[model samples]
Target: MAFMKEFHDLEIQLEDIRSATNNFGDENIIGIGGFGKVYRGSITHSHSKRQIMAAFKRLDRRYGQGDPEFLKEIMMLSRYKHEHLISLLGFCKDDGEKILVYEYASHGSLDRHLSSTSLTWRQRLNICLAAARGISYLHDPNGTQQRVLHRDIKSSNILLDDNLNA
Candidate 1:
């Protein structure tokens, strides 16, 4: 418990998460993956008292991820910061729940827009470039000797914002 104190600012109460996500209601579900379901919700900052839309990834033990994996993800994300990389806003680890809160991508994942006729060629190129940059940063983070390998690299893993940037 003492080790977790380092992340106090990034720790979010489970009650707040439940409230924002309507108790993890089906209506708020945005995506489902191996880890679990991702819900779209809004959480009010404890300090700022400002509400922000976020994506909450609730861990499902049946999916194989547990506390160790959850902690690893939090540590990695907390250490790394890049424009194209998804931002980790906060996390919930109360009541036997492990949830990662991320900045919401209004446009959703890259795979969803791949088949759309509305996606222009330039937009697709830009998305690819942005994703590449993010990957590059992870592989060789600035001023770090450690090389981070993203075992999962897929269109669905790449999220896009309102501007179609990945």
Candidate 2:
């Protein structure tokens, strides 16, 4: 009873905040998609000492309120730890706004590099190998198919770190 009321109140507050936020695509939006806009943010409220950019995805209300895929991804990622996979730092859910906070990649998508004249054949081959290995693990015979489908396979999804490796 009390919890429900609290949740409802929070939902209303979130909607107000969402509405008040700047037009996501106008400036701060680092990425945009059919479901939401990913904005860049700082780590002021978090416990981390090092400052790294974060991807703040605000779910688009036009699609529908709340996103099941986003929730499922966060819920599953919360239970485990891995290197190849991107970690979902946290998620904020409310009546109208659902935000997913993630570590931002500085180099942008692998495709951006691959499409450029600088990407050597060796680098492209390396990326292919890395992605194949990831897909194999996700599609392991013993593992359930739906656990991590890797359904959205694109050069943009592959992120490289400072060392130029996945």
Candidate 3:
């Protein structure tokens, strides 16, 4: 509960997230994993009214981990920022539902592009180095302060942005 204060600005209202994701409709689903399904959505800024793309990860009621794990992830992610890591925009926890909103990676995960012939040798190397830098950032002693270990390190978990940098 104390960590909540650290990310007060990142707490999103359930209703707003619901509206953004079309009530968590299946058609909007972009990915699925052990944790839950991810839906592509857009949120309109209150002041600018500009729509910002976001990926909504709704915790699966049947197989998803408990709220403690969810909060732990939020806390860790909110406290850290890295170019190779997915950006946690906000979170929603209301009425027994839990969801995490993240910056939308248009290119999706690294696994999706492994088979592409367009991937030059240099591009492949860039991806690998980017992922390594991200891991190193988590392990950095002076930077992050805490030695974070990434339990899930797989091609599927390495997301790529629009530029396909990593």
Candidate 4:
């Protein structure tokens, strides 16, 4: 139990170090939430030139649950790897700031399009279709016998690419 406790503390320390090392400029932050603030970051892994946008969630340092919850979400999200799901590129914690990085959608989110009254009906339907397909892909019906339920499906979570497609 002591060993486990030490390991957990070490992990938290490492996360803090990582988060602190990364720049937390206002320009880096893309969105804000009750639990954390997400930032836009570039990740070049193993020299692969992949242009991807990711959101980094920087947790509130005052909350002890931040790191654990962030880690838990990362683990679960990683296991839920799917094209439909926004990928977790990386994470870090700096002095209680737990940041989660994810792929960025160029066209922003479904909410952006909906907020505007100018969208044609056809465009809205197409967006809905793409979002549905993304959802179906995440369900992974072939592997899991248990039905997958999306407890928090929202327009803002639906990402759009540069091509104006979901």
Worst 10 residues of 1 by lDDT: 138-147
> Which regions of candidate 1 deviate over 4 angstroms?
46-48
List residue ranges in candidate 2 displaced over 4 A: 1-25, 45-47, 63-65, 141-146
Q: Would you give me the overall lDDT of model 4?
A: 0.62
* Model 4 poorest ten-residue lDDT run: 3-12
lDDT of 2 by residue, 52-98 (tens): 66667678867664567666656565544446555566666755457
Cα-based RMSD of candidate 4: 5.1
Each candidate's root-mean-square deviation in Å? 1.3, 5.4, 1.9, 5.1
The CA lDDT of each predicted structure is 0.91, 0.60, 0.86, 0.62
Task: lDDT winner between 1 and 4, please give it.
Answer: 1
Over 1-104, each residue of candidate 3 has an lDDT whose tens digit, in order, gives: 77787777887899988898888898899998876999998996543568999999889867758788789879888778888878888888888888888989
lDDT of 4 at 156: 80
Model 1 lDDT on a 0 to 1 scale: 0.91
Best by lDDT: 1
C-alpha TM-score for every candidate: 0.95, 0.70, 0.91, 0.70
User: For model 4, what is the alpha-carbon lDDT of residue 141?
Assistant: 55
List pairs with backbone clashes in candidate 3: none
lDDT sort, best first:
1, 3, 4, 2
How does residue 74 of candidate 2 score in lDDT? 60
Give the least accurate 10-residue stretch of model 3, judged by summed lDDT.
41-50
Give the TM-score comparing model 4 with the true structure, all chains together. Answer: 0.70
Off by over 4 Å in 3: 45-49, 141-143
Q: Please, what are the lDDT tens digits per residue for candidate 4 over residues 1-166?
A: 3523422322324333244436666766666665666666555431255654456666876544565677666665645655556766655554545666666777777887896787788888988888787678666556753336676789887877766677
User: Per-prediction count of colliding residue pairs?
Assistant: 0, 0, 0, 6
